[model samples]
Target: MPSSTQVQLVRRPRGWPTEEDFRTVSVELGDLAPGQVRVRNEFLSVDPYMRGRMNDGPSYAPPYALGETMTGAAVGRVEESTSDELPVGALVLHGLGWRDVTQADASAFRRVEEIPGGPSSLHLGLFGMPGLTAYAGLTAVAGLREGERVFVSGAAGAVGTAAGQIARLLGARTVIGSAGSAEKVALLTSRYGYDVALNYKEAPIREQLRAAAPEGIDVFFDNVGGDHLEAALDVLNPNGRAAVCGSISAYNDSAPKPGPDNLSRIVTRTLTLRGFLVGQHPDLADEYREAVTRWFAAGELAYDETVVDGVENAVTAFLSMLRGGNTGKMVVRV
Candidate 1:
């Protein structure tokens, strides 16, 4: 038997989650079953979606129970295996969440054989769910076309960073992004090849987005809803498309506030607004990997990871990311 450290939700948070909300404990793990494998968790993913899971409510994803280990995506090295399909020492990715060690049925884990080199955390970001979200949201939902202008809100995040670069690869004439910090803004413009980048924290978000896309936006990759969505709506060209990826701005609020005062603009501008979930377009994952891998290998694309070491700081990392503390994909090295 092996002892594993796991984090569980102590209580449902009222507003922003704090350290007190999570309780870490050591649990004893029994022997693996015939179809199971034991893994020593190496890296845990702390993402924006986990915040919604902490609450006791119905959502697109199921909420975490009060006493159960907090759910998250993680990558680990297999230490013991009872299944013939999985060999010991194989690195696999699974939804094992915040635990330092976990045992799973072989069916629940996916072997990461294609992605090479170290820092397999890229599997959680560029080559994983977030990457697929970036791809599907841009091409399928937003209906992006060559020579069109694209603007992304929350443009320095895991999905946002990928979105801008992917848009450029798809032959977009101009790519603009709005980020929370000056550093993130700089990364968007210089590192990610966004034609224009603005710091929404320094000035009015709508004004900066307006300045960036003066010609009016053809495709708006919306991540932060509320005012940003309204701003995007105001400048949307006729027949423009909007891919609603996330509404992080409103997530912390206990009550739904008046959001995006530009609802009427949707009608007049004839904008096409569609909400998206990455899981809805699972088939796009292969396409995303093929494209991004080529771009990365050719030095045409780049990515950054904001890693917070230890499971103890997972709550801190999550809150920091929501407060725009991260430049790229935020992960936990446990």
Candidate 2:
């Protein structure tokens, strides 16, 4: 038997989740049966989408069970294996996070190749779901064209960082992004290839966006809904397109707030707003991986990782990530 430390959801949070809502435990796992493998997780991902899963509600993915080990994306190395397909020492990615150790059937794990000296956590961040989300939203959903102007909200976070860089790489004439603070705003321009970065905290988002783009934006990558969506609507050019990836602004709201005041802009501007889940675009996985890998290897892409140490602090990382405490991907190094 192997003992593993994990976090479990004790209760559904009414608003912001607290430490009390989760409890850490150590459990003993029985020996792996045939075709089963055990892995020692190196990093566990804490994404914004998981916040919706904490509550019992309708979502693209199921809500977390009240008393089970919480699950999300994780990257680890196989320590013991009963199947030849996943031999010992193989790196793997799976949906068994929130734990330092995970055991499951070999079929549950997908082997990943190591890119020498890179942190394994990369699989849970820019090189993983966040990267794919940005790629698919811009290319497939928004149909971003060469020489178009692009804007991204929540642009200092994981998906936003990836979006700004990808939009530029895809030949956007200009890239604008909005972040919560001056530091993130600077990072967007200094490292992420954004041409204009706005500090939403310094001024009203709409005013800043209006002043920055002056003419209008052709594509909007919306991660923060509420005011950000409203601002994007106001600045979008005729025939503009937007990819609605998330609504983190209202995630912790006790009740639904009113929607964007300028939704009518969709009709006036002839805009196309498409809501998407990255899972819906699995067809683009190989394409995204190849392009991103090439870009990263060639030093064309840059990203930040907000790593919180220890599995016990996973709840802190998750809550922090929700409150925009992370600059990029929030991960727990176990």
Q: Count the backbone clashes (under 3 Å) in each candidate.
A: 1, 0
- List model 2 lDDT by residue over 1-334, tens digit each: 6899999999999988899999999999999999999999999999999999999988789999998999999999999999989999999999999999999999999999886446888888888999999999999999999999999999999999999999999999999999998889899999999999999999999899999998899999999999999998988999999999999999999988988888888898899999999999999999999998999999999889999999999999999999899998999999
lDDT of 1 at 232: 88
- Give a tens-digit lDDT track for model 1, residues 76-128: 88899998878998989999968889997999899886464437888888878
TM per candidate comes to 0.97, 0.99
Give the Cα error of residue 309 in candidate 1, in Å: 1.2
TM-score for model 1?
A: 0.97
User: Against the true structure, whose lDDT is highest?
Assistant: 2
Pairs that clash in candidate 2: none
Off by over 4 Å in 2: none
lDDT of 1 at 16: 81
lDDT score, candidate 2: 0.94
CA shift of 249, model 2, Å = 0.2
